[model samples]
Target: MTTDQWVIPFYQKQFKWLRDAEAEMANYLQIEANNIEEQIGIEFNSMLDIGAGIGSIARALDARGIAMTTLELVPDLVEAARRRSPKSIDIHLGDFYTYTFPKQFDVVSYFDGFGIGTDEDQLNLLKRMKSWVKDDGSLLIDIYHPNYWRTIAAGQKMKIDDAERIYSFDEEHCRMIDSWWHNEHPEEIVTQSLRCYTVDEASSMCEKAGLTITGIFPGGAMDFDNWTYKETAPLSGCLSYRIKLTKTI
Candidate 1:
């Protein structure tokens, strides 16, 4: 099965924890937001959070006094986001590629949710987002780094309470695979799925979409302690990038 086929249903069920998970993810994004805001030094008047799943990222921005609009393709997720932040702004339910924006936004972002689409879908989505961003507006994104799969393959696992999920395998091959289970969740329950993309290939696609890469944060948002990327913890497959991109002239 393709990434989208699995991810869409996975998220639909996973979002059942919207009440709790959204807040957790929001806290992490806030930390990222502060760092980027300091680097950019401009108050974003409005934000377009693509694939804003359950409004976690948008809620984070909203809490910071920034107005945000969420765009989600999943019907259930969109309704959930809209309900979660009813007083905030719009929650458009459709593929962002098909959705129309009333005006340009100061910031446009896709928080890992865009990874569901195929490479061509991803490229088209990026190019579409670039058109909605105002001149010099920033785009923040998060995706697992392709290089870290090797280290992850060496065997990585974390225990939560009485359960544990582990990932182990080589990533050098184009067909890389990784899997994990929620320690506390049921065995039949869905867990993490496999996804792959080289950094060079992803960067090239971003460039083609008319955005320049600025910073690449190197840590996944697994927990509070291991959020930031450091030189010491360089070989991590489960990583997140706080890429800063801007619309091309």
Candidate 2:
């Protein structure tokens, strides 16, 4: 199946739990919004969140008086976001790969969802995203670190309530694979794969897309032994990193 078609079922099954946890996820989303603000290093009058899941971050930023718009691919998530968000937040339901946006924004943030298809697909999306940013605006994207994913690719397994999750990696392609299934329905499994990139590789790709990297903030690391997460870590040790990009001019 194509990346777009497969992502629907994968994400629908993967994030189904988020449908009921909007209130519980508020604090986390607020922190994410704060991090985005700090990374931007300036006030933003308007923002667009691509691949917005349930619009939590949009609501968090909107609460802070920043006008927010969101684009999401999943119909269920789009409806949930619309239901949870205020009428002022423009929540559009469409694929970022083909959607037509009405205007540009001061900042465009894409959190946790990148590298869906081929390398060329990623480059194409970056070019499209650049077009949506105002000349002086910024783009913030979270990129999975290749080294970190490589270290954890030993088919680690976890049990969440009655469901089981298996994490593996494609060393050949530098992709992270996550699969999930309920214990009672072990035969039925849903999976998603995300391509990981080194900071240097991302820089080269961004440059080709007419964007320049301004800053990179390392994301947290998961401590498998303690089953906890560290809020900050060096890029070499972090699970992912957030890159702040601006127009190449």
Candidate 3:
């Protein structure tokens, strides 16, 4: 319904949602919440999952008796989420940056969907997200590390089910593209792009957004099933941050 982002219209009528592994991905977020609770010692009273896809994280949290509001850009996916999610979850379908949430949240999360726009645009989003966060609420986001993305060779292609996907990184534009099309209907191709970012860049954005970073979990440490966060990671590859954002003076 909203033409907020360039990719929104393409995804509105694309193939039936992501060929992604949703259940397993939800499990990872569950562990992440567990890890955060262990360290922060605060139960998430409410959460706003930005760019929520199929309400995976919402479902995971709902199972644990947590109240959550999920926002998604694509209408089809939002409809799918509405059909599958519990009545407890508050689902909103619109532009996340512009939509006004009804209440503040103890946590705001963006999973693997942090770098969809330019750096300044991203910082502006952070400022908007901050307005919805409670005074002590935390912001957990996963960002694409520049070092790891550089290692991936461009023009890589793969087939999933009946659809084939080609992935490439544009070094000059600093954006990564995932283009897809069905083998039987190669004529109808669709592509989605994301602007990549580094920790330093994200930090600067956070500062400009009037947010404080309490923790930074880099690399594979974000894989909840595999590792626990420890605040230290070399630029090995693919980093994520479980940052605790707070307001500045």
Q: For all the candidates, what are their Cα RMSDs to the real structure? A: 4.4, 1.6, 4.6
Most TM-score-accurate candidate: 2
Candidate 3 lands at a TM-score of 0.83
The best candidate by lDDT is 2
TM-score of each: 0.75, 0.95, 0.83
Candidate 2 residues 68-124, lDDT tens each? 999998888898888888998999998788888879999988889798999999999
lDDT by candidate, in order shown: 0.65, 0.87, 0.72
Q: What's the candidate order when arranged by decreasing TM-score?
A: 2, 3, 1
Model 2, 129: alpha-carbon shift in Å?
Answer: 0.4
- Kindly list the per-residue Cα lDDT of model 1 for residues 1-249, writing each as its tens digit: 233555665566555533354455655677766765664567778888887777766776677778788888777888777777858676787766678888988988877644554667778878888888888788887665655654434366554343454555444443234343444565745444434555676689898898888766655423325534442244244544556788766
Candidate 3 segments whose C-alpha is farther than 4 A from its true place: 1-5, 9-29, 32-41, 219-235, 239-242
Residue pairs in clash, model 1: 153-169, 219-240
Positional deviation of residue 229's Cα in model 3 after best superposition, in angstroms: 18
Clashes of each: 2, 0, 1
Better of 1 and 2 by lDDT: 2
Q: Any residue pairs clashing in model 3, and if so which? A: 219-239
To one decimal, what is the Cα RMSD in angstroms of model 2 from the true structure? Answer: 1.6
Model 2: residues with Cα > 4 Å off, grouped in runs: 17-19
